[model samples]
Target: MRVLTGVMLCVLLGALDQTVVIPAVPAIAADLNGFGHLSWIVTAYLLTSVSCTPIYGKLSDIYGRRALLLPAIVLFVAASGLCGMAQDLGQLIVFRALQGMGGGGLMAMAQASIADVIAPRERGRYQAYLSGMWGIASVAGPVLGGLLVDHLSWRWIFWINLPLGIAALILSNRALRNLTVHRREVRIDYPGAVLMAGCVTASLLVMSWGGSSYPWASVQILGLSAVALGLLVALVAQERRSIEPLLPPRLFGHSVFTSAVSIAFLASAAMLGATFLLPLYFQLAHGVDAATSGTLLVPFLLASVAGAYASGQAARRFGRLKYVVLTGLAVATTGFALLTLLAASAGPVAIAALMVLMGAGLGTCMPSSLVIGQNAAERRDIGTATGALLLLRAMGGAFGSALAGAVLALSFGAALTQAGHAAGIDPGLLRTGFRAGFLACTVVSAAGLLVALLMRDLPLRSGN
Candidate 1:
C-alpha cells in the first residue's frame, strides 16, 4: 500500500503536468505576450519527456530505482517552481524542458519500481492503480487549472505542484528505502543515448510542424524527416555495436517483447488519435462549449478506468493476458469502424456511448501488454523492456494523432475554401472530415488487432 501510494504520487505529478498546463496556455500567452510561441510551452515538455524515458529506464536498471526516483521527483519539483516564476515565454519553455527530463524519469521509474516488487501475474492490479491515476489527472487537470487561472493566476498551475510533489517525494523516499539495488558496472552508451534523443526530437518535430506549421512537403519538414531517419539508422548501428546499448538490441529478439511493443504503438496511436479528435468533434458537430465537451468525455474516461480494473482482475483470475487483450483490440476496432459511419444526428449520448466502448477496449489491452512485455524479458531487462514499450507507445500516439490531423485537414480544406469563412463552414463538412479521421483510426486499430492475433501468449510469471 505504501509503495503503491508513493508510485501513484509520482505518476500523478507527471500526468497532472500534461493536462494542467493546457488550460493555462491562453493565460500564459497573454501574460507573457507570446501568443505565437504558446505551443512550445507544451511541445518543449513533450519532446524532452518522451526522448528521455528510455535513458531513465536504462539508468534505473543500472543504479537503483530509489536512487533515480528521488532525484527525478526533486528535479520535477524544482523545475515546476521555476516554471511558475518565469517572466517570459523563453524562460518558461526552457524550464518546461527541464521539467520533462525529470517527468520522464518519474513515469519510467514508477512502473519499473512496481516490477521490482510485484510478479507479472499480480502486476495487472497495480497497473489499474496507475490507470486510475491517469483518469483522475485527465478529468481534474483542466478543471483545476481553470480554477487556479480564474481565481488566482496562471502561475498557480506550476506552484500547485510544489505541495503535491513534496508530499510525493516524502512518501516515495520512505516506501522505496528497502528496494534492493544491483549496481551494474557496464559502460554507459553515451553516443547511443545522444543519437536516440536526436532521433526522437527530430521525429516529433516533423509530426508537430508538418501540415500545421508548414506544408508536409516543405523543405523544413523534409530536412527534419531526413535528420530523424538518419539518426535512427545511426542509433540502430550504435546499439548493435556498443558494449552496453542505451536500449539493449537483444530485447527485440524476444517475440513477446517485439509483439507487445508493436501492439502498444498501434493501439496507442488509435486510442490517443481518437481522443485528440473527439473534443473537437463535439464542439464543431454538436455546437457545444469546451467545458461541456470535457464533461461529455467523462463517461468514456470512467469506462476506461473501469475496463482497466476489470481487465486487471481478469488477468489475476485467469493467469492469462493474450485473449483479454485480443478481445479488447477487437472491441476497439469495431467501435472505431462504427464511428466511421456515425452521423451528427446520432446525438451526444450516442457519441459518448461509442467513446465508452472504445475507451474501455483500449484500456483493457494496456495493462496486459505491459505485463506481456515484462514477462517475456529476462529479469534484469525488465526496465529496458518497459522503457521500450512506453517509448513506442508515445511515438505511436504522435504518429496516429498526426495521421488523423492530416486526414481531417485534407477533407476539411475543400469545404473551408468553398465556405470562404469560418462561420460559413458547414457542420456536415466537418462531420465528413471527422469521419475520414475515424476511418483512419479504424484502420490503425484493426492493424493492432491483427498484431495481437499473431502474438504468442507467454505464461505470466507467478514470481519475480
Candidate 2:
C-alpha cells in the first residue's frame, strides 16, 4: 500500500506538469517576451521525457528502481525550482528539458516498480490508481494553473511541484526500501543511448514543427526527417551489435510485447486525437466559452477513470485480459463513429455522453496493455518492456494530435484570410473539420481493434 501510494504520487507529479504548464504558456510567453518560441516550453519537456523513458527503464533494470527513482525525484524538484526562477525563456526551456529527464524516470520507474512488487495478474487494479491520478491531473491542472497565474504568478505552476515532489521522494524512498535490487555490473550503452535519443529528438522536432513552425514539405522538416531516419538506422545497427543493447531487439520477437505496444500506440492515437479536438468542438460548434467547454470535459475525464478502474478490477477477477481490451476498443471505435455524425447543433448532453463512451472505452485498454507487455517480457526485462510500451504510446499521442491539427487546418484554411487569422469561422465549417477529426480517430481506433484481435492473450504471471 505504501508502495502504491508512493508511485501514485510520482505519477501525479509527472502527469500534472504536462497539463499544468499549458495554461501558463501564454503567461510565461508574455512575461518572457517569447511568443515566437512559446511552443518550445512544452515541446522541450515532451521531447526529453519521451526520449529518456526507455533509458530510465533499462537503467532501473540494472541499478534497481529505487536507485533511479530517488535521483529522478531530486532532479525533478531541483529543475522545478530552476524553472520557477528562470530569467529568460531560453532558461525556462532548458530547465523544462531538465525536468523532463526526471519526469520520464518518474513514470517509467513507477510502472516498473509496480511490476517488481506485484504479480502481473493482480497488477491491473493497482494500475487503476495511477490511471486515476493521470485523469485527476488532466482535469485539475488547467484550472489550478489558471488560478495561480491569475492571482499569483505563472511561476507558481512550477513552484507548486516542490511540495508534491518532496512528498513523493520521501514516500518512495521508504516504500521501495524492500524492493529487490538485482544489480548487473555491465557497461552502460552510451553509444546506443545517444543514437536513440538523437533519433527520437529529431523525429519529435519534425512532429512539433512540421505544420506550425515550418511547412511539412519545407527543407527544415525534410532535413529533420532524413536525420531521424539515418539516426534510426544507426541505432538499429548499434543495438544489434552491442552485447547488452539499451533496447534489446529480442523483446520484439515476443508476440505479446509486439502486439501489446502496437495496440497501445493505436489506442493512444485515437484517444488523444479526440481529446485534443473535443474542447474545440464544444467551443466552436456548441458556442460555449472556454470554461464551459472545460466543464463539459469533466464527464469524459471521470468516465475514463471509472473505466480504467472497472477494467482493472475485471481483469483481476476474471483473468482474461485480451477480451477486456477488445471490448473496450470496440466500444471506443463505435463512439468515434457516432461522434462523426454529430451535427453542429448537437446538445451539450449528447456530446458529453459520447465523450463518456469513448473515454471509458479507451481507458479500459491503457493499463491492461502495460500489464500484458510486462507479463510477456522476461522478468529481467520488465523495465525495458514497460519503457518501450510507453515510448510508442507517447509517439502515438503526438502523431494523433498532429493529425487532428492538420485536419482542422483544412477547414480553417478555407474559412480564414491569407494572414492566417481566425476571423469568425463558420460553425458549419467548424463542424466539418471536427467531424473529419472524429472520423480520423475512428480509423485509428479501428486499427487498434484489429491489432487487439490479432494479439495473443498470454496468461498473466501469478508471480513477478
Candidate 3:
C-alpha cells in the first residue's frame, strides 16, 4: 500500500504537469515578453518527455527502478523550483524540458514498479488506481491552474508541485529501497538511444507543424518526415545487432504485445480527440463559460474511473481481457457516433450521458491493454514493454489533438461561409462543424474496435 501510494503520487504529479502549465502560458508569455515563442514552452516539454520515456524504461530494467526513479523525482522537483523562479520564457522552456526529462520516468517507473510487485492477473486492480489518479488530475489540473493564475500568480502552478513532489520523493525512496535488482554487465545502447530520440523528435515536430505552422507538403515537413523515417530504420537496425537493445525486437514477435500497443494507440487517439473537441462544443455551441464546461465534463471523468474499477474486477473474475476490451471499444465507437449526431438543441443531460458512455468505454480499454502488454512480455522486458505502449499512446494523443484541431478549423470555416452572415453564433454552422469533428473521432474509435477484435484471448499470468 505504501509503495502504491508513493507511485500514485508520482503519477498524479506527472499527470498534473501536462495540463497545469496550459493556463499559465499566456501569463508567462506576457511576463517574459515572449509571445512569439510562447508555444515552445509546452512543445519543449512534450518533445523531451515523449522522446525520453522509452529510454527511461529500458534504463530502469537494467539499473533497477529505485536507482533511476529516485534521481528522476529529485530532478523533477528541482526543475519545478527552477520553473517557478524563471524570469523569462526562455529559461522556463529550458527548465520545463528538464522537468519533462524527469516526468518521462514517473509513469513508466510507476507502472513498471507495479508489475514488479504484483502478478499480471492482480495488476489490473492496482492499475485502476493509477487510472483514477489520471482521471482526477485531468479535471483538476486546468481548474487549479486557472485558479492559481487568477488568485495568486502563474508561478504558483510550478511552486505547487514542490510540496507534493518532495513528499512523494521521500515516500518512494523509502518504499522502493528494498526492491530486488537485476543488475547486468551490459553496456547502455547510446547509439540506439540517440537514433530513437531523433526519430521521436522529428516525428512529433512533423505532427505539430503539419497543417498548422506549415503546409503538409512543405519542404520543412517533408524533410523532417524523411529524417524521422531514416532514424527509425537506423534505430531498428542498430537494435537488432546490439547486445542490449533499447527496445528488443523480440517483443514485437508476440502478437499480444503488438495488438495491445495498436489498441492503446487507437484508443488514445479517439479519447483525446473527443476530450479536446467536447469542450469547444459546450462552449461555442451551448454557450457556457470555461469553468462550467469543465464542470460539465465531471460525468465523463467520473464514469471513466467507475468503468476502470469495474473492468479491473471483471478482468480478475474472468481471467481474460479480450472481451472486456472489445466491449469497451464497441461502446466507445457508439458514443462517438452518437456525438456526431449532436445538434444545437442537444441539452446538457444528453451531452453528459454520451460523455459517460465514451468515458466508460475508454476506461475499460486503457488498463486492460496495459495488462495484456505486460503479461505478454518476459519479466526482464516488462519495463520496456510498458514504456513502448505508453510512448505510442502519447504520440497517438498528440496526433489526435492535431487532427481534431485541423478538422475543426477547416470545418468551422466552411460552415461559417455557408451560413452566409447569420448573426450571433450560427447554430447550424456550429452543429455542422462539431459533427464533422465528432465524425472523425468516431472513425478513430471504430478503428480501435477493429483492432480490439483482432486481439487474442491470453490467460492472465498468476505469477509475475
Candidate 4:
C-alpha cells in the first residue's frame, strides 16, 4: 500500500504536468509573447525529459530506484517552483527544461517500481489501476488548469504541483527505503550520452525549423539535417564500443523490444496529436473560453480512464493484448476520422462522442504496450527498456505537435482564405485552425492502426 501510494504520487506528478499544460498553453503564450515559440514550451520540456531517461535509467540500475527516485522528485519540485517564478518566456522555457530533467525519471521509475512489487500476471491489474489514475489525472489536469488560468492565475498551475510533489517526496522516502542496491563497477558512458543528446537535439531542431522557420530545401535546414544524421551515426558507433553503453545496442535485437518501442512511439503520436488539437476545437471552433473548452474535453479524458482500468483487468484475464491493443488503435483511428465529419458540422454532442471514442482507444493501447515491453525486457535492463519506450513516445509527441502546428499554419490559411479573411485572421492563430489540425490528426491516427496490427502476442498473464 505504501509503495503504491508513493508510486501513484510520482505518476500523478508527471501526468498532471503533461495534461494541465495543454489547456494552459494559450494563457502562457498570451502573457509571455511566446506566439512564435509556443511549440517550444512543449518541446523544451520533452527534449530534456527524454534526453535524461537513459542517464537516470542507468543510474537506477547501478545505484537503485529509491536513491535516484527521491532526488528526481526533488529536482521536479524545485523546477516547478522556478517555473511559477519565471518572468519571461526564455526563463520559463529553461525552467521547464529543468522540469523535464526530473520528468525523465518519474514515469520510468514509477513503472519500474510497480514491476518490482507485482509479479508478471498480477501486474496487469495493478497497471490498470495506475493507468486509470493516469487517465483521471489527465482529465482533471486540463479542466483544472483551464479554470485556474481563467479565474485565478496561470502561476497556480505550477503552484499546484508543489504540494503533490512534496507528498511524493515524503512517501518515496518511506516506501522506497527497501529498494537499495550496491552500485555497479561499470564506468558511465559519458561520450555516448553526449553524442546521443546532440543527435536528438539537432534532429529535433531540423524537424522543428524545416518547412516552418526556414524552407525545407534551405541551406540552414539541410545543414542541420546533415549534422543530425552524422551525429546519429557517431552515436551508434560510440554506443557499440562503450564499456557501458548509455543505450545498450543489444536490447534492440529483440523483436518484441523493437516492436514495442515502435508501437509506443506511433501510438503516442496519435494520442498526443488528438490531445494537442482537441482544445483548439473547443476554443476556436466552438468559440469557447479555456475553462469551457476543458469542460468539453471531459468526455474523452474521463472515458479514457475507464478504458485503461477496464483494459488492465481484461489483459489480466485473457492475456490477449494484441487484439485489445489493435482494437484500440482501430477505434482511435475511427474517432479521428469521425472528427473530420464532426468538425465540419456543428454539434457538441458529436464532438464529445468522438473524443470519448479516441480516449477509450488510447487507454486500451498504452498500458498493454508498456506491459508487453516490460515482459520482454531482462530484469536488470528494465530501466533501459522503459527509457527506450519513453524516449520514443516523447519524440513521437514532438513530431505530432510540430507536424500539427505546421499543418495548422498551412491549412488554417487556406480555410480563412476561402472565407475571405486570409489577411483578417492572424496566421498565428493555430488555435482556431482546429479543423485542419484535427484532419491531420485523423491521418496520423490511421497510421497507428497499421502499427497496432503488427504487435505480436505476448504470453497472457491470468492471475491479476
Candidate 5:
C-alpha cells in the first residue's frame, strides 16, 4: 500500500500537469506578453514527453526503476518550480519541456514498478487504479486551473505540484529501497536512442504543424515527414544490430504484443476524436456554455473510473482480458454510431448517456490492453514494452485530434455554404457538421473494434 500510494502521487503529478495548466494559458500569455507563442507552452511538453518515454523505459530496464524514478521525481519538481517562477514565456516553455522529460518516466516507472511487485494475474486491479487516477486528473485539472486563475495567480497552477512531489519523492525513496537492481555489462544504445528521439520529434512536429501553422503539402511539413521516415528506417536498422536495442525488434514478432499496441492506438484515437467533437456539438448546436459543457462531461469521466474498476474485477475473476476488451470496443463502437444520430434537439440526458457508454468502453479497453501487453512481453522487456505502448497512445491522440479537427472544419464549411452563410452561427448547420464529425468517430471506433477482435488471448503470468 505504501509503494502504491507513493507511485500514485507521482502519477497524479504527471497527469495533473498535462491539463491543470490549460485553463491558465490565456492568463500566462497575457502576463508574459507572448500571446503568439501560447500554444508552445503545451506543445513543448507533449513533444518532449513522447520523445523521452521510450528512452526512460529502456534506461530503467538497465539501471532499475528506483534508480531512474528518483532522478525523474527530482527533475519534475525542479522543473515545476522553474515553471512557477518563469519571468517570460520562453523560459516557461523550456521549463515545461524539462518537466515533460520527468513526466514521461513517471507513468512508465509506476507501471513497471507495479509489474515488478505484483504478479500479472493480480496486476489488473492496480492498473485500474492508474486509469482512475488519469480520469480524476482529467476532470479535476481544468477545474483546479480555473479556480487558481480566478482566485489566485496562474503561477499557483505550477506551484501546487511542489508539496505533492516532495512527499512522493520521500515515500518512493523509502518504499523502493528493497527493489532488486538489474546490473548488466551491455553498452547503452545511444545511437538508437538518439535516432528514435529524432524520429518521434519530427513526427510530432508534423502532426502539430500540419494544417494549422503550415499547409500539409508545404515544404516544412513534407520535409519533416521525410526526415521522420528516414530516421525511423535508420532506427530500425540500428536496433537490429545493437547488442542492447532500445526497442527490441523481437517484441514486434509476437502477434499479441503487436495487436495489443494497435488496440491501444486505435482506442485512444477514437476516444480523443469523439471527445474533441462533443464539446463543439454542445456549444454550437445546443448553445451551451463552456462551464456547463464541462459539467456535463462529468458523467463521461466518472463512468470511465467505474468501467476501469469493474474491468479489473472481471479480469481477476475470469483470469482473461481479451473478451473483456472486445466487449468494451463493441460497446464503444455502438455508442459512437448512436452519437451520429444526435441532433440539435437531443436532450442533455440522452447525450450524457451516450458519453457514459463511450467513456466506459474506453476505460475498459485501456487497462485491459496494458494487462495484456505486459503479459505478452518478456519479463526483461516490461519497461520498454509499457513505454512503447504509451508513446503510441500519445501519438494516436495527436492524430485523432488533428483528424477530427480537419473533418469538422471541412464539414462545417460545406454545411455553412449549403445554408447560404459563411460567417453567421446556424444551429441546423452546426448539427449537420456535428453529424459528420460523429460519423468520423464511429468509423474510428469501428476500426478499433476490428483490431480488438484480432487480439489473441494470452494467459497471465502467475509469477514475476
Candidate 6:
C-alpha cells in the first residue's frame, strides 16, 4: 500500500501538472512578455512528453522501474522550481520540457509498475484508484490553478509541485527498496530516438501552426511535412538493420498488435478531441468562466472513473477484450450521435448526459486496449510494447487535438454569417466556434467506432 500510494502520488502529479498551469497561463504570459509564444509554453511540454513516454517505458524494462521513476520525480521537482523562478517565457518553456521527461516517466512507469505488483486479475481495483486520481485532477486543476493565480501569484502554480513531489520522492525511496531490476545487455538506439523525436515534433508543428500561422498547403507546412516523412523513412530503414530497434518490427505483421494499436490510437483521438471541445463549448457557447467550464467536466471525469473500473474488471475476468472495448466505442459514438442532435440552445443537462457516455466509453476502451497490446507482446519486450502503445496513443491525441482545434477555430464567426442574426449566443464569434468544435468532435467519435470494429479478440491478462 505504501508503494501504491507513492506511485499514485507520482501519477496524480503527472496528471495535475499537465493542465494545472493552463488557467495560470494568461497571468504568466502577462509577466513573461511573449504572447506570440503562448502556444510554445504548452506545445514544448506536449511534444517532449509525446517523444519521451515510449523511451521511458523501454528504459524501465532494462533498468528498474524504481530506479528510473525516482530520478524522474527528482527531475520534475527541479524543473518545477525552474518554472517558478523563470525570468522569461523562453526559460519557463525550457523547464517545462524538462518537466515533461518526468511526466512521461511517471505515467508509463507507474502503469508498468502496477502490472508488476498486482496480478492482472486483481489489478482492476488498483487501476481504478489511478483512474480516479486523474478524475480528481481533471476536476481540480483549473479551479485550483485559477484560484492560485487570482489570490496568489502565477508562480504558485509551479510552486505547488515542490511539496507534492518531495513527498512522492521520500515515499518512493522508502517503499520501493525491494524493486527487482533486470539489467539486460541491449544497446540504446540513439538514432531511432532522434528520428522519432523529429517526426513527432514535425507533426506537432504542422498541427499547431497549420491553420493559424499558415495554410496547410503553404511552403512552411509542406517543408516541415517533408522533413518528418524523410526522418520516418530513415528511421524504418535504420531499425530494419539495427540489433535493437525502438519498436518491434514484427508488430506491423501481428494482427492483434496492429489492430489493437489502431483501436488505441482511434480511441485516444476521440477522447482527446472531446476533451478539447467540451471545454471550448462550456466557456464559449455557454458564456461560462474558464474555471466554471472546467467544473462542467465533472460528469465526464466521474463517469470515466466508473467505466474504467467496471471495464477493467470485466476484461480481467472475461478474457474477451476486443468486444469489451468495442462496446465502449459503440456507446461513446452513440453519445456523440446524440450530441449532433443537440439544438444550439440545448440545456446543460442534455450536454452533460452525452459527455458522461463519451467519457465512460473512452474509459472502458483505453485501459483494456492497453492491456491487450501489452499482453500480446513477449514478456521480454514489455518495455518496447508499452512504448509502442504510448507512442500511438500520444500521436492520436495530438492529431485529435489539432484536428478539433482547426475545425473549431477556423470557422471563427461563420455561425453569425450562416444565421444572419444570432439566435442563440450573445458572445457571437466565440460561442459559434465552440459549437462547431463540438460538432467536429462528434465526427471524430464516429470515426473511432470504425476503428473499434477492427480490434480482434485477445486474451486479457489473468496474471501478467
Which stretches of model 3 miss by more than 4 angstroms? 413-426
In model 4, the Cα lDDT at residue 89 comes to: 91
Task: Assess each prediction's global lDDT (C-alpha) against the native.
Answer: 0.89, 0.90, 0.88, 0.78, 0.86, 0.79
The CA-based lDDT of model 6 is what?
A: 0.79
Candidate 5: residue 200 lDDT (0-100) = 91
TM-score of each: 0.98, 0.98, 0.96, 0.87, 0.96, 0.92
Query: Model 2, range 1-464, lDDT digits (tens) per residue?
Result: 88999999999999999998888888998899899889899999999999999999999999999999999999999999999999899999999999999999999999999999899889999999999999999999989999999999999999999999999999999999998899889988899999999999998888888877887899999999999999999999999999999999999888888999998898888878987898887777776788888888898888889889998898788876999999999999988898898755567678788888899999998998898999999999999999989998999898888888778877675575454544377656767888898999999999999999999878887887
Model 4: how far residue 140 lies from native, Å: 2.8
lDDT of 6 by residue, 1-464 (tens): 77788888988898898778888888988998878888888888888888888788778888878888898898889998999999999899999999887788888877777767665556666777788888888778888988899999999988999999999998877767687777888998888888888988898898888866878789999999999899889989887877877775876567787777887787788788888888777766666876687778889878888888888778667756777777888888888777756636669998888889989988886677667777777776776677778778888888888888787647664454465643443565564566567666667666666766765676666676
- TM-score of decoy 5: 0.96
Residue 379 lDDT in candidate 3: 93
Q: Write the per-residue lDDT of candidate 4 for residues 371-441, one digit (tens) a residue.
A: 77777777778777777777777778777877776777665745665667434555345433666777777
- Residue 395 of model 4, lDDT score: 78
Q: Over 4 Å off in model 2, which ranges?
A: 417-423
Across 51-158, the per-residue lDDT of candidate 1 in tens digits comes to: 989988888889988898999999999999999999999999999999999999899889888999998889899999998999999899999999999999999999
lDDT of 3 by residue, 23-84 (tens): 87888888888998787888888998888899889999989998888888998999999999
lDDT by residue (tens digit), candidate 5, 1-464: 77788799888999999989989999999899999888899999998888888888888888898998999999999999999999999999999999999999888888888888988778888888988898889899999999999999999999998999999899999888888988677788999989988999899889888877887789999999999999999999999999989999888788999988888888888878876777767666766888777777788888878888888888888888888888888888888888788655568888888999988988898888888888999988988998888888888888888788777777675555466643365656677777888788788878878877877788787788
Candidate 3 pairs with clashing backbones:
none
Error of 5 at 191 (Å): 1.4
After superposition, candidate 4 runs with Cα above 4 Å error: 19-40, 146-153, 180-183, 207-218, 283-286, 341-343, 414-440, 460-464
What is residue 66's positional error in candidate 2, in angstroms? 0.5
For all predictions, the C-alpha RMSD in Å is: 1.2, 1.3, 2.0, 3.7, 2.1, 2.8
Q: Is candidate 1 or candidate 3 better by lDDT?
A: 1
